[model samples]
Target: MMQTALQVLDREYLEARCSLVELGAAFDRVDRASDHEENAGEFNDSRLELLKQALGILTEESHLPNRAERLLLLFSDLD
Candidate 1:
């Protein structure tokens, strides 16, 4: 679904193409230690919140009032 969105709106929402949540998770997992790295759940949580808010704006702009509605409309034939 994300790839679909990118293919459709890549030129317009270039910034939202990457997974902001996942990128922050990766960056936050980088350890200062020699062998092991702890998951930075807090950092990733913060990023998740921010990304959720940002995603809302993108969805509104894209006119996806409720994504599930769009998905159901698109796939209702399978039912």
Candidate 2:
């Protein structure tokens, strides 16, 4: 049986909200730690750029599927 939108939200909202909170906290920590550093160039790391791109994908309003796969592909290029 398919769950209604509200049902899905009820079941999943807390977990999703927590995940977002955790991600935000991690970014906050990074920013705070970077502020103490002497030479933290603006997004000097490729992983940070990838993380920003992944956040962009998450924030998109056009309902696209396979977001995890898309993010995986985005991160797969380690070179």
Candidate 3:
């Protein structure tokens, strides 16, 4: 079956979003690691900042309100 341009774009966006979520989870894990507590403080903060920037860019490009909320809820869940 041939996919339309929009279908292809949507699939790509979904894949990218999933990848970003996975990346965030990995960072969250590191942030919670007691063994790396001291260094993780700086590292986790930088990763979180970068992830937020990436999420902001994705939301802007897609003009998706739900995506922004999803990102917000994601970080909120970690808290």
Candidate 1 per-residue lDDT over residues 1-79, each given as its tens digit: 2557657675645564466666556555542331253543323345445445554554564544666565444444564
For model 3, give the 10-residue run with minimal summed lDDT: 39-48
Question: What TM-score would candidate 3 get against the native?
Answer: 0.41
Cα lDDT, model 3, residue 78: 66
Best by lDDT: 2
State the lDDT of candidate 2 residue by residue for 15-63, as single tens digits.
9999999999988888887877886634367777788899998877666
Candidate 1 stretches with Cα past 4 Å from truth are: 1-36, 40-43, 61-79
TM-score of each: 0.25, 0.80, 0.41
lDDT of 3: 0.69
Distance from true position, residue 30, model 3, in Å?
2.4
What is the C-alpha RMSD, rounded to one decimal, of candidate 1?
A: 12.3
Clashes in each model (backbone N, CA, C under 3 Å)? 0, 0, 0
lDDT value, residue 16 of candidate 2? 97
lDDT of each: 0.51, 0.84, 0.69
Error of 1 at 57 (Å): 1.2
